[model samples]
Target: MTWIHLLSKSHIPFSVYKMYKGDSLIQPKTIKNTHILVILQGILSMYHVLNKTEVICNSIVYTGHIITSNDSDYTYNYISLRTSYIISLPITTTDLNQYIDHKIFNQILYNYNNTLKQNIDINRIFIHKNIKFRLIQIIIILSMKFGIIHNQKIMIPLIIHKIDLANILGGNINTINKILKDLDDQKIVTYAKRNIYVHNIVFLKYYCYLLR
Candidate 1:
């Protein structure tokens, strides 16, 4: 069962917030009660603010992913790449034991575990220095998670900024643009203004294999 199913069926209290594209959802500094944030719809980029100015995007969060309070020690700013619906559920360690046998709790645990595993996989990608491979792998992951088939091509529908992409991939903006240009030249993918249309998924996969 998915988190949406569980949320719909369970009696757990949740508060939903709506955001427009490019809207910033600021993390409250004085949250007295701990709550789990779930992305019910749309995509968001979680950024870590440094010195109250510099921002570093750490992850691309899609629907069904859970964000816990302990995930970051610094303040987080969630920026919407599309219109998003997020729900906050107040949950505590002691509170979980009461629903241990329920499907709602089980589904929550499943999603949480998957989220952790995905984070670990993404972290491993950073260990490699090859920016091209890293970028392609990230696109593959995004396509699998959220891309839609349009005219036989996989289109990542989110409106992402070039700077955000660079921050996530840990590459320079010029380098990222050049790599994307090379892919476009080969007709493997079309990237313009943050929208990516992957025409040849097979070629992307094989290219990654060759790079390894």
Candidate 2:
């Protein structure tokens, strides 16, 4: 699918494509165009070549984030998912400048620029709490967008791995393991293999402070 077809009315010029493992996706060279990835399913990891850092896992990359390709020669990077639906917008700086609100865009641009300036540790502490909030937000957004399949109970085809959660939460593998164990102890979630069974969504909402 093309960006025109996905976002039919928006004047944003983009192209949409489905990618899987070994698809020869773009390697990590910087480009003038902006890409937005809305994950329909599966997982993905973005790695920064210059710093040798992985930005986030299973993250839905939006307009605000800056990324580098794993390969230097190409304008794209490899996606670490079995399958993903992605939209690439061939946008000029002028087009982006006009579309994005100036203040927010400036802030994002500043952050991206700063990120490129130094070697960033993937396990930084400055954004720990904010990272948790964002991870929960992603869950809420996915819940609303894709919803759950009805059976004797409600289930979502959550194909996420522990390492992926650690990346998204900006924590270590052991930390994520602890968190999942805590959640399991509370009976809010159950996991088997790579699938997460949300047994108690309401309880989870309260536990995560999304509800009171």
Candidate 3:
């Protein structure tokens, strides 16, 4: 089931809006409306702009994410990585608490838990690994989430810049450049024409020896 399914019985008021590429889904400031932001379509990336650099807070949110500001202060900034559709539904903690004991809520909880597990996996994969290994592992994770297979190669949906990759990896641009070079040299992955294509998954997996 999808978020739409969960919202079917919801009488809470909502407003749907289209966000083009480069639009802000949520600004870094407090909001009067305690609305739950839902990704209706396409991919969205959560980012924090620090010292004029975009630090990735979350990987591409594929779907089923409910962006909420339960606290009084809200400052999470979300940007459209691709053209996307989104809706803001006004909700309260009381309203959410009421649904906590249902089967539908359990399924939603599972989805959130799955996303948490992916983050944990990423942290583990990147920790203490060399730049080349971390770079390859990240490509594998992105491929699993957003890749399309063609000619036995995996094509990811978005343009991947070295800086963006660096931000995701928590590394410097020069290091990411070096790692990208190594990945290309090893035939593990390559980013070109605003897209990343994984050339060989089986060989890449062997290189990473993914334990999970």
Candidate 4:
């Protein structure tokens, strides 16, 4: 995926939504109102039992158009593959009509829609390489968004685990562990108590290039 555009602001009311691992915020049950979900941080997975499908992070799900489970007994899980930040757009039909008619908002939406439609094919043979590239890109973007000055280190406070990393990278736990160990050995990162201290951001970026 490429940085097609960045949305610094939104006309709609934006809330910093957060979810923990294994937490179910939106059950399978459908809501009458419309909502737009934008993944700002972290990763989440949505499983559609009816369609036997699952969607991973960086996916925009339109709740109004999708039919999900309505059974009260049906339990839908919104697992946080990792700690996540999401923007929820809560708008009624009338609100949507007015919002969509705005030229600026429409243009932003159009570009994102087009970007979503572009196909980026991946193969198993090259999956690891692709994942490393994507993760490194994500790290850079997050650094821009949330980096902090800690002992002169550009540290990201998010406590990400191996399982979460695996989910985000579309790799398995073993692969993530190996990568983390390699980085640890190189003194690029130090992991303790779920906290990842990036000792050398420059070297990390360089390692990402090596993978490429």
Candidate 5:
């Protein structure tokens, strides 16, 4: 269990929130404070609409992960990709002093922030011109998020929508479809009924080298 779950069960200044699919989390006129959330159930997506026709998906927050937002980061509307439950907690200087084990708690916070930083940096793949590289990057990100290794293949536990993946990767639907089909044909990955299973981690992980 994560720190947020510990905080919730121990009654350490946290609240469990339930959000349904398509519910708006932040309004256009809303200004929020610095806070953190732990997704307990489903995925939460942050997106912004521009000029009534353009929609940009900024990020997708998954289950068992922490999401933090400050004033500058709350510009997009955060919506539930599916029905989700989350834990919301404030993280003030005073709150830090209240932790029962500040050292471990501090370490947890540090580690989570580091992962968040990596997530932000890796998301730049959306700008890459190579669709193959872009899809590989997305797969790496998802593998880290929800992968379970079994019999040499890494399988994501959730049923991920290919359309959502296309939006996230900043690629056309047809391109994503083609790449996925090719991957399946090449035995590098297996995609069926919205489920993604990686057959060769070594082969799949090779594309991540381009990032460096």
Candidate 6:
């Protein structure tokens, strides 16, 4: 009964992209102007590869978030962090202005802009911070976004590897490993087979605040 369902039943066209974990989502070269990406399930890591070696993580797109893809140049690359379902609506500005209700259309754009701004803000705020602080902050972000509450703790179900964290924070793998070990030693978080369990989120928040 949602607007999306209404659109699906209507004349407007959209594509549902299914991606497995670690799959590269190559943006179709034919797409021009803009398209709206709605994450129906799982997470996506948006980044730009430097020298085809380093991955500079731009943002994390969570389920239900609307993302605007306007770059015809395709400067960013999207990778699935977990099995995901993405709805790509190739609705242009002209289409929006013509077909959609003004209020609803405006709200969609506003939500996308706000989410993009928040991601940019997080990157800017943590750019100058220590690696450990950055790592902890990201863990907090992911835990809140993708976690399930169980046994009075937060359990992040995604199988996020050390290399993934390293890529995200732009840190060395060994350094990220050491930091994870330290966190584990302190009982703040436990990593088992790349799955993260936050044992003391309160302490993690306090530590993050102190580092800020």
Which candidate leads the pack in TM-score? 6
Residue-level lDDT tens digits of model 2 in 29-139: 654335533333344445333445534332333222344333344344445435665555534577666564544345446645543442133333224475444444455
List the lowest-lDDT window of 10 residues for candidate 2.
Answer: 117-126
- Using all chains and alpha carbons, the TM-scores for the candidates as numbered come to 0.83, 0.54, 0.74, 0.55, 0.74, 0.85
Query: What is candidate 6's lDDT per residue for 1-212, written digit by digit as tens?
Result: 24367556555677788899998765543466466777778788777645456557777776766755666554567888889988776576777665676555665676687678767866764575599888888889888877898788799999998888887787889999898899889889888888999988889999888887
Candidate scoring better on lDDT of 2 and 5: 5
lDDT of 3 by residue, 28-120 (tens): 555555565666676665654443554445444646555553434435567776777777655568766654336546755765675567556
C-alpha root-mean-square deviation, each candidate: 2.9, 8.2, 3.9, 7.9, 3.7, 2.7
Task: Give the CA lDDT, 0 to 100, for residue 165 in model 1.
Answer: 75
Once all C-alphas are superposed, what RMSD does model 5 give against the true structure? 3.7
The most accurate candidate by lDDT is: 1
User: Can you write out model 4's per-residue Cα lDDT over 1-212, one digit (the tens) per residue?
Assistant: 11112222334454556766555556554544355555555544443333336534322122111212234544444556456655555456775665443553565466455434421211222245566566555555445545686776667666667676666556788876776677678887666676666776888788877877
**140, model 2: CA deviation in Å?**
3.0
TM-score of 5: 0.74
**Better model by lDDT: candidate 2 vs candidate 6:** 6
lDDT scores for all predictions?
A: 0.77, 0.50, 0.66, 0.52, 0.70, 0.76
The 10-residue segment of model 1 with minimum total lDDT is: 93-102
- The per-residue C-alpha lDDT of model 2 at residue 29 equals 62
